[model samples]
Target: IQQKEHPKFKRKGDDLFVEHTLSITEALCGFQFILTHLDNRQLLVKSQPGEVVKPDSFKAINDEGMPMYQRPIMRGKLYIHFTVDFPDSLSLDQSKALEAVLPPKMTAQISEMELD
Candidate 1:
């Protein structure tokens, strides 16, 4: 039997994928939330402290996906892909505060520029 749609997750084979969006601060500082699984189970999807999830990064929760066809107790993996939403710009005060908490920016070196 084949099903058409699901409210929270998209599936492939037995594996499930969910696209999660996080703010820049959340991505950088780490994120945590409860996800409603395919079987109506609430699962914790979290990142380690100080573990920054960069834009378009992926995390996985094993044995949390759909159950196998014949083996009702066996399940696949749940994959979470993160999309970091960064603001276009920050105010001077905000920038300063962020700078203080973050590592120093890496500077690029260049000698000269030629315009056409």
Candidate 2:
């Protein structure tokens, strides 16, 4: 896991800005598996961290038939899982535009396990 600190700003008074520092942490989880054949005892092995997000989290269903509550996880971030993976060569402007459409913290935390 890696943590980075960034300065945050808020408007105060007529033309003043207040600043504070915030931290962000990133972690990588890995998994490995092996398949073995009984006849020759041959083994096939694979290892991966998997994709950042799962697809089903973005699926939409009729509210009438769906359960009263639903939870989803995306990009290792809970509740804020609605994201589209563009090609590796996407431009910086394109990426920023997509990020602008993300849900706010409260909506994103709708499925969070932590109380606070």
Candidate 3:
């Protein structure tokens, strides 16, 4: 974490000015998705793993068995960062499966995994 000093402000006269400066440090954590457009395009579709996928890859099936091949823009390194609020019941095999899909260099940091 890095500490940054920012100026505090107060509005008094017509001219706005900083009354004082305060130092603060903020901590932020979240998942990051790095996707590459399969078609070599700049547009990227980002979402968490197991989240609602884009409309293209999956098709809504009706009782009549109507199949629609909605090609979603696929391609890119999807990085998912898990927080402390993440579930603790995940198994090692499941985690390994996810790591396999990632690029050779990309790896997930699993902080805790204990078998009973």
Candidate 4:
């Protein structure tokens, strides 16, 4: 049966895509949340400690999306497209705190620096 829309997610073929926004803190420190699926299932979506989810990146939950058309046993993947919501500016205290908690910035090789 065709429906007008699924409020929480959008479907592409058999896969489902969720557009989610995370605070800079959540992106860096990792987060956990529950998602209500189209079929009335609660899904746990999370990130491991120290796992940074970059902006515009995606993580997929296998077999958690839509079922294939005419294929009941098989299911598509749920893709969470993350957008990191960074502040326009950070206070000195916030900056210092982040520096202490986060890893050092990655240094580029001499060859790669030329591309910057």
User: Whose lDDT is greatest here?
Assistant: 4
Q: Which ranges in model 1 have alpha carbons more than 4 Å from their true place?
A: 112-116
Instruction: List, residue by residue over 77-111, the lDDT tens digit for candidate 2.
Output: 11111233335565899768656864543544354
Tens-digit lDDT track of model 3 for 1-116: 34244243222222222211111110111123332322243432333444533212322212212112352232222222222233456599977875686557746666556432
Q: Which sequence of candidate numbers ranks them by lDDT, best first? A: 4, 1, 3, 2
Best by TM-score: 1
- For candidate 1, write residues 35-115 as lDDT tens digits: 887667788888898899988888988888788989989999889989999999999999999899879999977656733
Per candidate, the number of residue pairs that clash is: 0, 0, 5, 0
lDDT, candidates in the order shown: 0.86, 0.29, 0.30, 0.89
At residue 109, give the lDDT of candidate 4: 69
Q: What's the distance in Å from true for residue 114, model 4?
A: 14
Each model's TM-score?
A: 0.84, 0.18, 0.18, 0.80
For TM-score, candidate 3 versus 4, the one ahead is 4
Predicted candidate 4 versus true structure: per-residue lDDT over 1-116, tens digit per residue: 75578676899988999989999879978899888888778888999877989999999999987889899799999999999998999899988988897789899667866878
Higher-ranked by lDDT: 1 or 2: 1
| Residue 38's lDDT in candidate 4 | 82
